[model samples]
Target: MPLSNNKSPAATDIYTISRLNREVRTVLEEVFPTVWVRGEISNLAKPASGHLYFSLKDSSAQVRCAMFKNRQSSLRFEPENGMQIVARANVGLYEGRGEYQLIIQSLEPAGAGALQLAFEALKQKLAAEGLFDEDHKKLFPLFPKNIGIITSATGAAVRDILSILKRRYPAANVIIYPTLVQGEGAGIEIANAIKRAERRKECDVFILARGGGSIEDLWAFNEEVVARTIFDITTPLVSGVGHEIDFTIADFVADQRAATPSAAAELISPDSAEVLIKLKHREEQLIRTQKQTLHNYQSRVELLSKRVPHPQQRLIELIQRTDEYSMRLKHQVEKQISNKKMAMTEIAGKINELNPAHKITQQIEKVNVLEIQFKKSITRSLEKAQDEVSSLSQLLNTVSPISTLERGYAIVTEPKTNKIVTNTKHLKSGDQLRIRLASSEIDSTVDSIHEK
Candidate 1:
């Protein structure tokens, strides 16, 4: 707008809308430096230009406020009408319209309301399911191969984790899976990045991290998909979302929970030099125990040798016992032989006293008497034979012819030396002859007898 020069007999100076707006902006900036204003939000408009135009009022008065796209991206949660909030902003005039409003730089909850109730309800629901149970939590790997990070690539949380992991263990590897950590569809993106890392098997462990913000700002980690994905991950998870006081569903289901991005790095890997020293100490202990065992065995061997007797002494004792037994056995056998000899002598004397020779002599005398009786029988048989011979001779005489001559019958004889009157021839010769009657004998040599 053009300004009039001095002297009141003048025409009005015309100013363009842009010129007036610039002048008003200068005035408003000077009157109100950047400040914090508390009010209830209403008539909120979110247009395609990525800007939020809203009015903040109490019961009686209201003022317009604007949140540009660049500033809107910084808000962690959606803004709506009838929400009580405290806006930290600067008072300014719109260059196009010359209207004054607060250019909000930051925002926060003004009172405990719907948001606080929703927070408590979610916390209770997840807690009842044992999502926050320590027993179900996986212990972060002591030596992670590659730690995955799911956060904005340019965020300070990434730089913090990388710096800490490198300083503690220089050899540890890291992989970043970029994701939106807040706002619409951000929770899904954060969950998807975690699931993709698991599918790819790219990292041994994961760290979901972001710098501290309002509860609304950290709500992405509290979403259902992000929480379940952390619970379901095969890779061990480490959550370092927000500050120490901040808690989310991801923190409860994660394998390990760290209070900050730097703390998460520490949990993943510790100092290498300290681990080496502990191993060396264990090795020394084992060596000492083995040496003690060897010494004990050697002592036991020496003690056992002292308890055993020498072989020569054992043999000498056995020989003396054998000699004593041999002498006793020989004495017992000799005594038995002497007793047997005495018994045999007594038996021989008894046999001699019982002889039967007298009885045998008596039997021989009886046999001689029987022989005498037999001889008497033989003499009687001889007498009987003589009587038989005499009888036979008498019988022969009774039947003889000479018996007739004896009864007075005469007989003649002729002989030289006998005479008989039988033949006259013999008488002529005058031979000598003897004749006898029956009573007498006749003797004749040659005689002639005459025929009667």
Candidate 2:
């Protein structure tokens, strides 16, 4: 239906819907150029257009507020439903709906976002100083000998870090540099603690940490002194200043940054279980190498004994050398097995010591499995080595001339000269001769000589 602007004879100034909405918007804008409205947010809608449309209301009344993408960029915190927020906005009337609304220019948490601005400022300053450079960031040691914790003495952050460090790496020595993690003078104390730890050079890594809190509560970590101190430390520092969502100036300057205190502990320590597996692998590799070396030695000995022509004395020396090598190989394998076993025992003991009650049973079962596997591997290696040694001994015996004596052979020699009489020309009748058999020697006088 086409609506006409029908005006009474006395009412010459008739308004259309568009003209009315526009006039109302101009008047509203003029009346409230910039107003600070504090209310609880509701019906929050963030569309793909990057505009936020939400209802800011009190118990009795509500006004629709629209924060465009450009204006929302100035928000210090994301506006969420049920969030108590204060917004600076201009009052206007929407022409399309003829609805009254507020166009939000900026937003912040009601009376609680100044610290965030300060945090951003300090972060930028430190970053510009190269404190946050990747080159300046040191990788946390895989296995720190002494793990230093800098946090409140009685806070949950300390307890969490200690618990995690104990569970993951019980062998590491923990040194707590207890200090205030919040409030006045906390930043100075934190900086001093870092300096003390650095001067003493006792800890391999440090955790600068605190529990999650409000921005103001965690402001100490955003202090310039804390950032500078963290940047100057040679020992790597991990900042777990707050919860995963929270970050501070110290986080930017620290060598490593973790989401929480427990995470910081994880960054600095090696898991005992993983270390055990790696040791097992190393032991197996050593066994394989030793086995291969022994096999090669055995093969070389067998080849030389069967094919190489040498004086009897020289062959005897070669056999003695092969025996020495076999003995050395046996000793080496034994030594390696002993060392690996001892190391595994020590590591397992450490793991057992700190195993949580809930996990102890599982840990014990795993250790048992590993132990059984280790023993089986050792047994196989020993058996294989013994078999090779036995084979080598048999081969040595088979090539020996003494073995021929057992086959009904005798050697005739001059008794006085102890020289073998290979030919009859070397002996005469009535000459004393010695006959050597497999088990005994006999004395004989040669009355007659047989040529062949």
What are the Cα lDDT values of the candidates?
A: 0.66, 0.77
Candidate 2 lDDT trough over 10 residues, lowest sum = 354-363
lDDT of 1 by residue, 1-452 (tens): 34367545434355568987888898888889888788999999988888889999999999999988887655655788998887879999989766888999877677423454466687788789887788877766665656788888999999999888766665556799999998899999998998898999988788889989877788888788888888787788888989998887788888888999889888887665554345345434533443354344334322332333334444233223322332333233334333323433332333223211222233234333433433343334334433433344333322211122454666666554333364564265545666567568765555454455
> Per-residue CA lDDT of candidate 2, range 47-70, in tens?
999999999999999999999998
TM-score of each candidate structure, all chains considered together: 0.43, 0.60
> Candidate 2 local accuracy as lDDT?
0.77
RMSD (Cα, Å) for all candidates, in order, is: 63.6, 18.3
Which 10 consecutive residues of model 1 have the lowest summed lDDT? 351-360
Q: In model 2, how large is the Cα lDDT of residue 51?
A: 95
